[model samples]
Target: MDKLRTVSDTKRNFYQYHNRPINSIYRRVVEELMVEMHLLSVNVDFRSDPIYYLGVCQSFTQFMNGYTPESDKDSIFRALCQSIDNNPDEYRGKAETMLNFASQKSPQELINWLLSPTDDNGLQDVANHWRYALENPKFKYSRLFAIGLYSFLAKSDAEIVKNEEKFAELITPLTDKLSLPIDKFKKDLELYRSNIEKMTQMLTVLADTLEASKKKRQNN
Candidate 1:
């Protein structure tokens, strides 16, 4: 805790002269803190909430040397989503930044963010509403309804969702399998977890390919 505070304070002091030398001592401080966070994993279950999402937005903005465009809110939003999907621990420090400059994200954005980390089982907190909005979608946030539901379904139980449009053909039979009701959420979390794992694998493969290409080019 003291280390984090020391880094935070160091950044504050460095901000005064950082423009003159531009070494950005604070950047190193923040990165060290991020490493500490990776080791800690303090907030293991950060229940996909508005505050958490907004915090991620703030963290990116702050790390970019303290300038965020008014017009590029969507870009910032997407980056935040991607970062959270990448590292949940780094997101804890994000809360401070988010509290200052971030806006509350749309429900659909929230849902999609959760769904995109499909392989990370930590994100299943929002599953109950996945199909509810897909079928009904009455409110202003309805625009998010379909996309969120589809993302969730694709990562969870694609078969049920693929045929969900045929409410009679699919949802009816599913209503019996779980023995609860057709609409009640089934715990097919493996779908989301597998998706996240797949993404991690793909990223690893791409990174390896890029590194190999760089080495070959250097050798040439």
Candidate 2:
């Protein structure tokens, strides 16, 4: 059997591809993702599903948006997955596939599909597995999975997700159905969104500082 990669191994692989140190501000985001992915990869019940992949892809894209040496972004992403014995392309492709599928459905239709036990559609298998995991006491729940669930709802109906009351209404039924921890899931997503906003502001400030420094050097 192939040995599982450690967090240190994954970090080494990530840096190897980038060929430069990650910016201090963004290093936490990258390392957190690496650790999360590594933990999920090692968990027996944490299956690599489209929803989870969507979470991983979204988090990586949003957090690493302003990385320096823009050219190294793809390499960094590839190394992240490779280090964990996963494929970056698969993660991106699956995330896109899930989003596309969700986008084409109405909010009600998406909910129905998730609740349906019949395997009539492509999403049914994913739903089935999700339900199984929800019921399994041994299944590991992570922030990434919560983000995936949030992404699914956002993709299905942007307006509903934006409206606080509507969003809760939409989530309540699904959480009740799956016996999920509604409070924890919502809290994690809330924190995720808040952190994203903070990161965006920090990136803007960093960019402004760099631009000012560059102009100062040019004027010298």
Candidate 3:
């Protein structure tokens, strides 16, 4: 059996990889991500894939957009993956591959791929695994997985995802077909979108404030 990872181990690995203490403000983010990844990693039924990695990468990038000492962002990300004994590069590379695959297909094509198996290769193999997981009652579902599905939909049809009515129309039937918890999936995606908007607004305000301060200093 694999030894369970603890928060302390994550922190230690983070510090070691970063070569310094993480900022107090950002520490919570790291801890939360560490805990989530740890739980998913340990779950016997949980399978890590490109879609989930995309979710992790997207969430980390968006949430840490304005992290101070910007260079530390890469170090912190690397540390987070290394702490879990996973490769950050694999996450990034696979996610990019998934994104590229999604970009080439229509929303319906993507949905059809998920609903029915295709010839096994590349994205088709991923789709096959997703179909199997959805059918398995023991599959461990997480917010990260929900985000991954959302990301794929968004990539397949940006306009549909942008509109609430259209998005619901698209996801409702599919969720039902897969026996997923529709309410919970919708709720998590709603929260994710809301948090992202709030973060963007806050970043905008901070940028404006800094610009004003810089101008004031220049005028002095």
**Per-residue alpha-carbon lDDT of candidate 2 for residues 27-78, written as tens digits (9 for 90 to 100):** 7887888888988888887766666778988888888887877887788788
Per-residue C-alpha lDDT of model 3 across residues 51-157, encoded as one tens digit per residue: 68888888888788898889889888888888878999988876776677778888777777666647545666556555666566665668887787788878878
Decide which is better by TM-score, 1 or 3: 3
Q: Considering every candidate listed, which one attains the maximal TM-score?
A: 3
Candidate order (TM-score): 3, 2, 1
| Local lDDT at 61 for model 3 | 86
Point out where model 1 deviates above 4 Å.
1-74, 78-184
Q: Estimate each model's TM-score.
A: 0.25, 0.83, 0.85
Model 1 over residues 1-220: C-alpha lDDT tens digits? 3343343443344343222322243345244434332322223322333232332333334333322233443333333233223433333433333222212433234335433423233333323332332333221221112222333333334454555354234333323332322232333323433543564565568679989999999999
TM-score of 1: 0.25
Give the higher-lDDT candidate: 2 or 3.
3
